[model samples]
Target: MNLISKLILGGLITASLHANAMIIRHDVSDGKYIQQAADYPAIFPLKDDGKTKNCVGTLLTPQWAITAAHCTILLEPDSQLEIAGNKAKVHSIHLPPEYGYMKAIKNEQGKIIDIEDKVKDASFDIALLRLSHPLKGVQTFPLLEQKVNVNQTIEVMGWGDFGNGLEGVSRKERVNDRQLRVAHNKIDAINGNYLIFNFDAPDSKNALPLEGINGPGDSGSPALIKLPNGYFVAGISSGGDYPGVQTHKREGKYGWQEYYININAMTAWIAETMALSITKN
Candidate 1:
């Protein structure tokens, strides 16, 4: 089966086997900014054929979407890029040569064999999706002019897989925690081209808290910075591991999330790309 089907099936299998279940029901506000984000959040479904694989994106510009390099591999050049406020036909996909990697092989004798070819890096796990047309949504979030200081609180939002499905079977009835959950943590040391968040969960037994969050569907959700004027798109939620009772590193350590591709780190790249687009047009 395809990737999305596999994911759905896996969720089902896990739910059937595990008796302890967790459900996510987050409160989403109808306030101005929250409404805007809820209505036009940058996140988009990455589709292959007719299946929804995963969500990956950022609203860098009204006409441009930023996402990881790995996500681009599944995309066709002409795939439709849809957001809350607008839809655009992808005109082009640009990826850096060093963004992707491959593994080496071994012979039956256990000797080292040929190594796979190096794929593109997705430009430091980053990419730009140029839309065939512009969007008419509210002004795009600002770009960080300087590198965001470590420990600055940032907001993240997404509609991803949450809780065991045994609690509810209807897909549309699943919880929508669209509220912008805020997490305050220092920057764990950067890894290659990604930024990491030191998300400390509570010491209590209940592992699933509404505010203390991160999960499967949150990948590629924008890490936003609230500035004097407004919020700026700062980083992308990559992935993280939650230590269960058996896997807890310490008695009190909570789950941690590591973000990849600091938008500020790619400020020059963003400026140059937009400038070039503007100039060319």
Candidate 2:
């Protein structure tokens, strides 16, 4: 199966873990921007029960957050966004028109049945969430409007799930009290709206000090880039790619390809969406 198909199947075909994505080959303490809770308050978790994180999102404004479109299933009226010990209710969601092309088949229980063949447009795997109220006192992230080059280093932050690339993502590491972790990886390729990265082995020459990739439970997490001025939201954690390796598979081991929805390509759509929200209120 293709990498995108495998990723969609892993989440839809398999049971929902409702956990956060973990960073392989890195510990929480080693994170430069995510070591403390207050460091990057803009990053938060999207939850249905006001606790269990279904996906991660980055704050664009006090009332706006950006995440993957597939995560919209969890953003019910009662869904909550937890950030820095504060919880905000999700008011509404917005998606690109092309997202309609990527349909998901669900069973009677509202559980996703199959999306392997239905995911037609991976390029539009992006979404914006409007919160009921403004997240006062919290800083928001700026969208990356500039083009990103391949091999550019980016900072990835997410919540929950923990393990090294060697063992892959361990179910034992999935925790309820999700811990936020950060790691670094360089973009290996760019495909349409996606920025791709290969999780290099620890000893690999191209490996960063905290080289890692997103594992299950981290969908919608932000891939941040530190520009000369400040930090920018460069991409969103969309899925993973494992071509031929049969053993480790999508366990987030070395050689896994991480696909992030490029944010620079959708800045215009994001601006227009946020403007619509302003017009509504």
lDDT of each: 0.50, 0.75
lDDT tens digits, residue span 183-237, model 1: 3344555655666664443333332233333344444556677778877777765
Worst 10 residues of 1 by lDDT: 15-24
lDDT of 2 by residue, 98-179 (tens): 7653455678997666653445576788999888898778888878878899989998877665666776775445544566
lDDT against true structure, model 2: 0.75
Instruction: Indicate which candidate wins on TM-score.
Output: 2
What local lDDT score does residue 220 receive in model 2, on the 0 to 100 scale? 87
RMSD of 1: 9.6
Tell me the lDDT of candidate 1. Answer: 0.50
